[model samples]
Target: MMIHRLGTMLLLIGIGALPAQSQVAPLAPSDITNIPPDPALKNWSVRTVQIPMRDGVKLNTIVILPRGIKNAPIIFARTPYGAEKALTGAPSNDFRLALPTSYADLAAAGYIVVVQDVRGRYGSEGDYIINRPLVGPLNDTKVDHSTDAYDSIDWMVKNIAETNGKVGTIGVSYGGLTTLYSIVNPHPALRAAVPINPLVDGWMGDDWFHNGAYRQSFLDWVYRMSADKSSKYALQFDRQDVYESWLKAGSVSDMAKQLGVDTMPMFRKLVDHPAYDEFWQLQALDKRLGKEPLKVPTLHVHSLWDQEDIYGAPAAYAAMEPKDRGNDENYMIIGPWRHGQGMVADGSKLGAITFNGNSASWYRQKVLIPFFDRNLKGSADPGIAPVTAFETGANEWRRYDRWPMSCASGCPSRSKPIYLSSGGGLGWTSPTGAGGFSEYVSDPARPVTYRQRPILGTYNPLTTWGQWLVDDQRFAEARPDVVTFVSEVLTDEVRLAGQPIAKFFASTSGTDSDWVVKLIDVYPAEYAEAPEMGGYELAISMDILRGRYRESFSKPAPIPANQVLPYEIKLPNVSHRFLKGHRIMVQIQSSWFPLYDRNPQKFVPNIFTAQKSDYQKATQRIWTSARYPSRIELPVMP
Candidate 1:
């Protein structure tokens, strides 16, 4: 009976095993679809092709055309960033959905948009050089950004069947730099160009170094950009706080070594040229383009609070204004925004400050699109002003016949000096006392942070580096190393419309030092609207200058210790009003860490390679007496 029961169970198991054998036989390789069907675009068709350059290098170009549309003008953009990624994402019927926020208004207007990867980045062929210089002394190669842009545009007009043979270029930051390059020797088809927050200069104050201080925070970006051809690799930090990591790394050289970026060609170039040498001067766009006559109807867009390329647009505008004989070819727009904020973000607000309206949207719909239409499509004139600037405190847009109306070479603006007095007082009158000074001990070990602590990496998604320029300045108010001077509450609105110059009469105990000057707007202590802004210290224009470069930006010299000298620091441009009932404040400090590399008190041949021993505490003095009047020269608008 037991043997018969076992046989029945074995028979059932055999039946299950037969099914398993069939499964193991791999029945007909299941047909599973991996890719989804392409979306039927209603108004747009996309295609990518390799556009050959004059050098025979094929550049990856993405062309987006308005379906059923004919003879549309081409809006061309050349960028080191991926062209494919810029215009492609989840498939959609509405082409506007795939377009970047900056191009939304342009896309709705019906035009062929072309984006190409610059040489040696993403899918483009040829070597990638940082801010590739024009075909000149710095660039000995047969092809530079100028020639490549010309070649690409030449090919674009001839090959693109739907294009009207008229092209306009637009881009931000490095893209902006390339846009400016395209117009150097513009193609016949190139008509209009817009360069927003472009990198016009590096050694003077755009990207790499500001004045003589190295922007060490950009090293991470350098590493990521130069790491791979596709720019896919990101630099990973072991510590969560970039400030801590960078501080621990000591010198810029040490930081580069620790981050394994010391071997990068850009890094090596930075280390090799610590001064404003010919290498940097040769690549300065403002200097190069300024000398040439305006060939394209170019509109330069500047941001009042641009953190990355603050010195670019204004500098370039000043350089090119001489050539704009009719004040028609060269135009400028300065808005209240961070770097490239007007391009991709709603400019209504930056950090906690609100501008009350969508400044960016207004710029696009009202100014940008119309400008392009008139230039590319031969539409009616937009009648835009030569200069359109957004006034911050007033929260209003103001049009001017010319920018910096107060202080340009031919403008009517006059620079008036506001003196710093003893006992933390600041006023328009010069100091009367013969001898008075404010003293502080500047320590490299505990340098004043540029912003709130735990600063994130420059390129981190959640990083506050973009908005740090607009952050409240109260964080550095109570620090011992920082000296504060305040003016009485304003009875009337004080409007400044141009660059503010910091002329310091100071001395340092150490051979070398750094000076940071901030012009701040202090709100009333109590406020009904936006209570959080009460007593807020908003920096209007601020910058740092290494003492070594006080005499000349290109040269470095040790200070005559304990002897007061005149230090003239040129702060970035500003268009702001110190409203009635508010106060003006000026904070002076010796260091702005992580943002700028620390300046060792003891003079070293190169601050990048300064040793731990070179770093030292120094006694700094700001003399504000009649003999040594430390004052800020403001282009006060009447």
Candidate 2:
């Protein structure tokens, strides 16, 4: 039977021969699709059930089984996003629905596809918590995502009609979080898992916070989640200008008040615990996984330019991969795409950079399919490497036995600092004479925008904000508050892999400040194949550090005014090759604008409580002398 038989019902209702259900609205004409379901819904069976959890909460689940297949290996996905969206192609009110990339492919191969809303989400019972903490020592009373997944799989193997008991879990982003959780203490039926761009640590890096700097874009998320919306999609502001609205709010505390904090318990918890207290520590995946070996063959997917969750994939792999070192059970794929771009078929070009071919399609057909076929179906191994990564500038895929690839071919095993010099030069040699430092005044009132003007909602796909990573940095060029240092055109191709560390010997005139270091690749001025590529300042890797959290995240202390301090900012790992004639550039600024909340300059107990008076202009200096040689350490590949 058709899941939605609205066509005939609509015809009958139009002629007044039948009555419509009060709660059910007919499908919109625009939603009618000639695109048939994979394996054809006509040849499959759809079942929606509330699977009982250990704690008695029933998770809303949808199971699609191919009609003629018996004992089909199950491909399961759990998300906070509604299961109905994943089932019938219904629209979700939640954040953009999890990418439905290779779902059809799996279903077409006679796999039983399962999608579920985790406990406390839509159509489920229990109090919803973001990044639910693990319940150490599993018991009947203790219920977490891991236990829930174990229970769900146990119940499915016995209750479902399918004979083949093998199961695999895969998800992207938050869904990826659940996928990761399932692997910690997995069920016997769980054979494989793929977590793409998962948010690994709550305190250090990911969507919520970077270093100690809180990501301001998530305020939009908090607002939407607080409301009684159908799904956790981004809240649409009444006003067209979100940037101006945030500017007027003054502080995060004030913004909460404007959003009616009484209704938002999560927002309250977020600001109340500004530091990395027990709240965030309990949620860090790395700390929870602590030396525990992975339970299954895992495939980790990542993108170097991922706007969010840039630190999760690599961090999680490093934490759990040691257990599988001898067996080659843990694998990773790093691509030159944006957040979750590896899921879809559009990895050809992002902003001005092009990958030359459909990378996502290739990954789906060759990498993903082969992995699942071998692991879940007892087929021969595809001979995948431990790490398959795409080098950006060189734009080629390379396989390695280990990540942070061992320097077998004379590639530098360690990083060496390239010193910053006066006259806007960057080189391996340190500066000698006077004028050895660069100075700029950072004013919170006139903070720099992270992207070009008219910055729209990030969750919405129609906006230009998604391509900010690959955007040319010339937009901020010549700004009084922004400082730029460049290296001479490379004589030969300079390839860099692994982490880029920014070491700054600097002093701020104020008590508190924020330091943003962006490692950039400058296209030659004469290059003009693409207008956006001409003199493009593509950011390869960047990081921001709030000076107050320099020592410890839990105990933040202000710097002594005008006292120089050594700050080491570890940027996310990257794989890129700066071709000959391309200049290596470094851009230093105090604010990343709406991307990160502006630092008040003056020290406050809590930044959320900081008043407008706390915001001040501060003169920031980057010293490049022999005594204080400020530099960035690049992991060069020979």
Candidate 3:
């Protein structure tokens, strides 16, 4: 969703994107498809204004109001992307409101809809800071996104006409981050907020780095939103095959030079700090949330398979839920969606897999509409559940008073462990003897492709890279470098409702390495209901751990060659059901490129600065002996 070379497609910008929290949001089907403008919009007036901040910088804002409506509650959205065209430009006047779409419904329901460009973005005055850090304990002169939101809301309520003296904020991706920031220092009139797929932590998850593993996708993203806010592809390459160009460009640092990144401040700053240093830590919104949760009621929505920003929503909800227990104000909804797919009407499918119903439409109508109506417009409570999520294999939606419904009180959910045997078998029994392990040679020059084909730019609408998380894992199933462990066909359903922990007894032939663990659900070969579902290898949850950072992210030390070590890789929490006759699988590999930048098997002070010679082929081992058993711990559901 980040502005790309195609010249800032307003609907596409931040539709499904993030940053170091700035990764680009992806476009939903509705974004590209055209619908005719609604005749009802003719009754509404469009006004553009330069709203001033405390520091005197002005933001470009657009207000759309129904002429006959008065005392309407204000529905506000702040975005880093341009607001003018998206708010007014359109074929289907209904599409004007952008993702959380249903503009016609909101307008007909009587509300003052407003959209504004965040300071430093298009038509706004000020320097832009990507994922601007939330300034804690700031003086009146100190400014941050939190202050910007506060200032804007303060001005709107005081000057804007025909208001019910109430305000609500909502956005997806970066705008979601802004929504999160808005409530960090909320305005008096701000009644409710919904932050969809917001980037909660840039260092551990979400946009740039994940547990010290730098995502190359960040580079592709930052390039699209350069200092001058132009297209990265236009500035760098005219060629379509981006993968070949990236490979030819060589190392991570070298790619910067090829992109002519001398003027791209964000890229420079990012490469300079490759670790989870203070720079990334400061931008993390979850850490900034602190012990005392925000007082404002919030509904945090996210997709289970969101290519970007997957870690933010649940993390933010968990952090706040404990403090706001029984308040019925903190809520979360996770679906089988890609980034920003929650806003699309047809959310039943992602690539080859399909859910039974239109999940997105149900959410918008049954949840979002009622949530705002009650909180912002003083209507009856919708009585929504605290957690509403979709179960993948089951193809159904479930609600809970709390997420991951604990089994302590005889709930259906349970936790089970599946061990890796000496052979390729996955079973409940642990290995008996000593010195049993599986080894594979990982060649840096021949790294496994993150996807089946060439890697594309992050914003390429033509590519399936955006939904690669849910892509068929069979692409890498036969690769020699990947070690596979398979479980027998299950007799009953096995539902995983929480985080799955990977306890790996691993070693490398060199000083440094990377461990990528994938928890997969393999369909039987004779699957009949859906032919494409037959032999499907779907990755339920997966994560990587940089061997050097196994000890500390700040001080990445090398591993002793051939000495086995225990590594704990906590995959993102998943909601899935492995049905009867299906087999569970675990794939262990050394590299997943260029989804994650290649890790030099040899120890280096910094991977970003490593020379070509630093990259080496190493034989990685996964031990399953009784002395050091490796297994996957699943939060099973009853």
Q: Pick by lDDT: which candidate is best?
A: 1
- Candidate 2 residue 310 Cα shift, in angstroms, is 0.8
Give the Cα error of residue 41 in candidate 2, in Å: 7.3
Q: Could you tell which candidate, 1 or 3, scores higher by TM-score?
A: 1
lDDT: the better of candidates 1 and 2? 1
Predictions in order: lDDT: 0.88, 0.81, 0.80
The true-versus-predicted C-alpha distance at residue 291 of model 2, in Å, is 2.4
Give the better candidate number (1 or 3) by lDDT.
1
**Residue 574 miss distance in model 2 (angstroms):** 0.5
In model 2, the clashing pairs are: 71-163, 71-164, 94-231, 94-232
The TM-score values for the models, in the order shown, are: 0.94, 0.89, 0.89
Error of 2 at 344 (Å): 1.5
The segments of candidate 1 whose C-alpha lies over 4 angstroms from its true place after superposition are: 1-30, 34-41, 88-90, 406-411
The Cα error of candidate 2 at residue 132, in Å, is: 1.4
